[model samples]
Target chain A: DVKVTQSSRYLVKRTGEKVFLECVQDMDHENMFWYRQDPGLGLRLIYFSYDVKMKEKGDIPEGYSVSREKKERFSLILESASTNQTSMYLCASSPPYLATQYFGPGTRLTVL
Target chain B: SQQGEEDPQALSIQEGENATMNCSYKTSINNLQWYRQNSGRGLVHLILIRSNEREKHSGRLRVTLDTSKKSSSLLITASRAADTASYFCATDSGDDMRFGAGTRLTVKP
Candidate 1:
């Protein structure tokens, strides 16, 4: 079984503060992604990494940045947290050429 | 730029009844997948149907894909209270998988 673990399940931060959400996968998958889930907007991709030191911007990557210094770990960074950025964040990993992705428990972020 | 969009945002059904949800995508896809998420938890993969394949099944879940129409449907048979959750359809275009808004299903006791 593949397992992906997030650094936090719930987090609260003040406005303009910096926030970091970490995700680690044990499967050594080559692909990792970060998404934010909102009520009507659905899960919008923030950023994704295909390999170590490689990153790509998704549909809604303006306020978010990601790091993939190693194969097993991916981190999402918020430059300046705002209330609008508060949403359920999810991380996922998939093996090379595989469409089936394993997800980690989401981190519900609340920016006050 | 969303890839998948699910119809009927919410559905309510009684136990033992079957539930069906539909999803439509914009561009061509390599595969389509169905996933279930319980409230605040992470998503659990249910099934995947490849581009060349038309249908696939696992346990009580059945998935069918129509490449020409760029759409797919998922059916859950004999749904129980435990099956009440948000169902999302994801489209894979080789590089990444994009998900739909999801359909929230409520099972009445």
Candidate 2:
């Protein structure tokens, strides 16, 4: 079975603070993704990494950056957290050509 | 715009009954997948159907895709209370996977 783990299940931060959400996968998948899910809005991609040091912006990447220094780990960074950034963040990983994705328990972020 | 949209935002059914959901996408896709998410939990991959395939089955779940119509449907047979969750359809466009708003299903005992 594939396992994807997130660093934090819940987090609270003040406005303008820098926040980091980490994800690690044990399946050695080549693709990893970060997404924020909101009611009625669905899961919108924030960023994705196809390989180490390779990153691509998704539909909504504003105020967010990602790091993939290693194959097993992917980190999402919020340059300046705002109240609007409060939402459930999910991390997923999949094989290079597979359509199935294994996801980690999401981190519910609260930016006050 | 989201690549996929699920019909019937919410559904309620009794245990032992069947539940069906539909999804429509705007663009061509390499494959379509169905995922289930319990309340406050991560998503679990349920099934996947490639563009060239029309129907696929996994246990009690059945998925059918129509490339010409750009749509897909998922059916759960003999549903159990454990099947109560949000079901999402994701589209793989060879670049990134996009998910729909999801259908919230409630299976009452």
Candidate 3:
């Protein structure tokens, strides 16, 4: 079975603070993605990395950045956290050429 | 706007019944996948059907795809209380995958 692990299940941060959410996969997948899920708005992609050091912006990438220094890990960075950024953050990984994604337990973030 | 849209945003059914969810997309896709998300949890991949394929089944779950109509349907037979969850449909358009808002299902015991 594939395992995707997130660094935190819940987090709280003050406004303008920098926040980091980490995700690691044991399946050695080549693609890693970050998304924020909101009620009624659905799951919107923040960023996705196809390979180490390679990143691509999704539909909503504002105020967020991602790092993929290694294959097994991916990190999402909140440049300046704001209340509007408070939501559930999801991390997913999939092997190359496969659209089947394995997701980690989400991190519920609160920017107060 | 490659995001798929699921019909009947929410549905409630009695156990032992069948529940069906429909998904419609705007663009062509390489494949379509279904996922189930328990409350406040990550999504679990349920089934994946490629564009060329018509129907596939895994246990009690049956998925049918219609490329010409740009639609797909998921049927869960003999639904149980444990089958209650949010079902999302995703479209893989070769570049990236886009997800829908999802249909929330509730199975009454």
State residue B90's C-alpha deviation in candidate 2, in Å.
Answer: 0.6
In candidate 1 the C-alpha lDDT for residue B9 amounts to 95
Candidate 3, A91: how far from true, in Å? Answer: 0.3
**How many angstroms is the interface RMSD of candidate 1?**
1.0
Task: Report how far residue A94 has shifted in candidate 1, in Å.
Answer: 0.7
lDDT of 1 at B97: 79
Q: How would the candidate models be sorted by lDDT, starting from the highest? A: 3, 2, 1
Can you give the lDDT of residue A48 in candidate 1? 88
**Model 2 misplaced stretches (Cα beyond 4 Å):** none
Give the CA lDDT, 0 to 100, for residue B48 in model 3.
98
Per-residue lDDT over A1-112 for candidate 3, one digit per residue giving the tens place of the 0 to 100 score: 9999999999999999999999999999999999999997789999999999999999999999999999999999998999999999999999999889999999999999
CA lDDT, every model vs. true structure: 0.93, 0.95, 0.95
Leading candidate by DockQ = 2
lDDT tens per residue, model 2, A15-108: 9999999999999999999999999888999999889999999899999999999999999999999999999999999998888999999999
| Clashing residue pairs found in predicted model 3 | none
Task: Give TM-scores for every candidate, taking all chains together and pairing residue i with residue i.
Answer: 0.97, 0.98, 0.98
- Report the Cα lDDT for candidate 2: 0.95
